[model samples]
Structure formats: structure tokens, C-alpha cells
Target: MATTASTAAVTSLASVTLEVADLPSARRFYRAFGVDTYVGLRASEAPSTGFRGFTLALTVSRPSIVDGFLGAAVDAGATVLKPAAKSFWGYSGVVQAPDGTIWKIATSEKKDTGPDTREIDEVVLLVGVEDVKATKEFYVGRGLTVAKSFGGKYAEFAAGQSSPVKLALYKRRALAKDLGVPVDGTGSHRVVLGGTAEAFTDPDGFAWQPAA
Candidate 1:
């Protein structure tokens, strides 16, 4: 995506993953925002990759690890969809969380390369919501710069302006229609960056900056 002229060069971000209850919900959510989708998992049963030039893993079943964490998270206000357990791959597993609209928790797959190392690229998400004006004001009030108001229907903002994070907004229904979906937001979803601190809300849902 082409960034604003004043914005500095942003480091590339890798793929963004959503742990959803149903694949259909994911399709509706992203389709609304005009995000390109592709078949992720390979014929060999590996994770999905290559969407819009980024490697994407649609869903990963890691029961062994998820089960232990689900117990702790539920006690802290998380709505559990499925309890974690061992998966087919034999690793710790989990694949359910429906109520927590914001799921910024990091998965086990990503590694922390530290601030000095350049391992991950940046991520920019296009959010679809019910209201455009309200969404724009909400994010701007939270310290995000409105880089450009795309004809008053969509807006793009730097994730942190300096940190390699980015966020984009759009009307949910319109966005869904553009992406070939009727509507969206039927399941859990989140956009996470490896290392940045930012948060904001669009018309339909909330978005967090770099993962904590």
C-alpha cells in the first residue's frame, strides 16, 4: 500500500492472523474491507500462506498450549468458544474465543527478534464499520493521525506514526459489499503487530497496534 508523503518509511509487516470460530465469519469480516483472500492451508495440511503478498495462516490448532491459557484468560473476562487441547499435529492447542472483540494475544509461532533485529514486516489493516465519521473521530482522539481522508468514506492512519504499525478504516456494509461479502463480524478477529503500542476503534470493531 502507498503511504502518505509525510510518513517515513515503515518497516514491512508480516501476515495478520485471526483465530475465528468459523471460516465463514472470517470471510465476511475481511471481505467487507476489500482485503484480498486466498486459500491458505497447503495440500500437505500446512498453514495458509500468500495473501496480498503476505504469508497468512488462517487458523492453527495448537491444543496443548491453548488449553492451559484458556483457563487463565476466561477468569479474566474472556469469553471462551472452545477449550484448548491437543490437536492433530501433537502440539499444545486451542482455536476458540468469540466475545473478546479484541484478540491481540500473540501466538507461539512468531518469535521476538528484539528491537534491533529486522525480522517482521509491518501490518496495515482495513476495518469496516457502521459509521465512518464516528470511527475517524474515535481513532483521532486516541492519538492516531488521520493521514488521509479518502473521500470521507475511508481513512488511513499511521499505526504509531513512527513505529512500523498502520490502520485503515471503512464503512462495514460498504466494505463487505466491495469485498464480495454480504456482511461481516460474525466471529473473533484481531490485527497484531510484533512490537508497538497503539489502540483505536472503528465503526464496527476495535483495533490494537503492535502486539504486546
Candidate 2:
């Protein structure tokens, strides 16, 4: 949601393909979120449950804009997982989209000084994996560089030479807790990431197909 708006133009994520049951409904929901672009939609009824092992983040510029995007999601039939609130890091809110993707709208800026704008600074796709260091190594072997990291707690990869949507890794339980969801998931991740050097599955079974 939030336009799939991404400033995460640094590794892969050439295309964020979401496999949804209802294309028309999904399209409308995303459109109402003010996003007419990004994220490919395919028809699928894959049985996925619980947390889905990942979350999409819309990083905006201010708290007000964060509120705007979060509100848009609520209006679009998304369930609020966490209400918008200021925190030590910044301000943010979490919502599970109608299609079951957990999205976080946030900003490093804790306060609003001017009128809100629908500008997303970064669209981060955080994968909740079982192991951060190992997965980080897996991605590095696949030609991604580390953008930022903190021991084994978390790690982010540089955006591909020509792509949007930065990729990051975090402990699965930690991510689920952060998103206010349970720490168990089964079946397809319901997502096929584009823009990989080659098609392969990760250590955690997340699929990566070549970007077309």
C-alpha cells in the first residue's frame, strides 16, 4: 500500500509481485491507497497463514504524512495492528492489508512542521527470517552488499545497481513482535520478488524469480 512508493533504490526488488485471490479488489485497495504503480499482482489462492514472514514498510518524511498513509490503509479495509504513535525512533503505525500483507508506515522525523505530502522516502521489504547473519551471508553470496547491520539482530542490503525497494533481514520472532503479530507462519510466503541475478530460493524458502 501507500503507492508501493519506494525510495529504496539502492539492490534487487526490481518488481514486488503480490499473489492475491482477487485482482480487482486488490487493485482497488491499492489504488485507493494512492498507489497507481509498483508491485505486480497475480491471481492466486495460495494457503498462507499467520505472519507471512515479511512486511512492507513505507518510510515517509514526517509524522503527519505517516498518519495520512496509515489512515488511508484503514479506509481501504486494512486492519490496524498498531495505532499510530510517536516512539523513541520515530512515528509509525502498522496495518494488515485486506490481502494479508503487513505494512508499516513510518518516518524518522518525529514531528510535523508543514503540511503533509504523499511522499515515501523508502519502501523497505523486511523479511523475517530464522537467522539474520546466515541470511545476510546468503544474500551477499548472491551479489548484494550490506548497507547497514547490527550484529545478528538485523541487516539491510544495498539496493541493486538499478532497482527500487531495499531488502532487509530480521529475526522472525522479533519482526512478528514488532508488527504485533504471532510468530508462526506456514505455507507460501505469497510473494515472489523480482530483480534477482538468477532465479533461486533462499535459505528460508522465499522465492526469487528473475525480474522481467
Candidate 3:
């Protein structure tokens, strides 16, 4: 739990809206990964270009599961950016969803000492912002408690031990460098985050749709 004071207005991550060129294609692709994506906006309204400001991460409980997910993604027509491999933190891999959204599947070996659940244990929506400090403060002010922070470089919020999803903020330039991409991205982000708030746009232009 967060030791710092919190309003606790926001409870959990309900969903994420991705702007894709082909809604049906994107839906099919994500559904293949076990996501029940809600297609709210129309195809004509979606931007021609895809958003690249964020990456969705799926954390599992074991290395074998990570490999399984990577294989499934490949079979689902997802382009593999990185094959499943062992890392200092764990075994992981990266794949680009058909709609251009990057999905990283990983499992921390240190945290994988337990039994294999063979399932996605957690979903992390990692937002890349131009100014990490400002973004961190913005979310913190909105009743979110910071679970861990490292100066302005990165921060993670604790939704709860049982919460299926978690939120994280990262430096845009740093994240771009890590992903081997350019720092600047254009077009409507077409991503919507749902919370307790009615409807608002963050400092970085990410939209938040209030949960019904």
C-alpha cells in the first residue's frame, strides 16, 4: 500500500482505447492475446496513423508462460520485435500488435519462484511522457498513490495486490531510446483511459474516459 496520503478516487484500470486504422483487424489481433477489447469509436473516426506514446505490458508468473505468449502472438500474426530471452530482470520479449501498439510480455525470474499460474498475472499501462516529474505529480494529485519512484525518470503506482492492472510513468525520450524509436510521435493518440474522473485529458494529451 502507498504510505503517502491518497484520495483513492481511482480504483483500477478499466480499459485502454487504441487508435487503429482497422478496428476489426486490431480487435481480432488483441482478442487473440486474450483481451476483450471494446470497440467504442467508429473506424472513420480513428486516426490513420497509430499512437506510439504508450506500451502495454503483460506480466506473467513464469518463463515458460512468457515463451508461450510470444509463440501465440506470432501465430496470431503479430510481428515479433524481440524473441523471448532471458534478461537481468527476467525472461521477456516484445511484439508489435497488428495495429502498431507494442506489447511486451515478460516474467521476472526473481518473482517467478512460485508455482506457474500459466496466465497473465498483471497488466501495466506504461505511459511515456515528455516530463516524467510533471506527469507523476499530475496522477498523484488525482488521488493516486505512488508505490515507488526514481526521481523523474520513472514511477509506479500501486493499484492493489489483487488489482489486475497497474499504472506506470516513464520518460518519453528514455522510453523511445529503449524501444529504438524516435522521440517525437504525431497524430491523435486515440487512446482512452477510464477511471473515476468524468472525462479529461492529461498534461501529455492522453484522454481519460470516466468509468460508467
TM-score of each: 0.39, 0.92, 0.82
Off by over 4 Å in 3: 1-12, 37-45, 48-51, 110-117, 160-163
Clashing residue pairs in candidate 2 (N, C-alpha, C atoms within 3 angstroms): 3-35, 10-159, 10-160, 11-159, 11-160
> Which of 2 and 3 is ahead in lDDT?
2
After the best TM-score superposition of candidate 2, give how far the Cα of residue 45 lies from its true spot, in angstroms: 1.2
Residue range 1-212, candidate 1, lDDT tens digits: 21234433223222334434455644553443222232111112123221111112122223322333444445444453333333343322222223123221123433222332212233345666566777677555544567778765888775553433356677666655433333534423333333233233234544334543
TM-score for predicted model 2 compared with the true structure: 0.92
Q: In model 2, which range of ten residues has the least summed lDDT?
A: 1-10
Candidate 2 lDDT by residue in tens digits, 1-212: 01122322214557788889899999998887765475778899999988799998889889989888888889999899999998999999999889998899988888798767888788888999998998887776666789899999999887765566788999999999999999988988999888645566788888888887
Clashes of each: 22, 5, 0
How accurate locally is residue 180 in candidate 3, as Cα lDDT from 0 to 100?
A: 52
- What are the lDDT scores of the predictions, listed in order? 0.39, 0.83, 0.72
Candidate 1 lDDT for residue 61: 27
Better of 1 and 2 by lDDT: 2
Residue 101 in candidate 2, Cα distance off native in Å: 0.5
Kindly list the per-residue Cα lDDT of model 3 for residues 35-151, writing each as its tens digit: 544323225364435336887888888887787777777888888777787878888888887767777888887344555444788788888998888888777777678988999
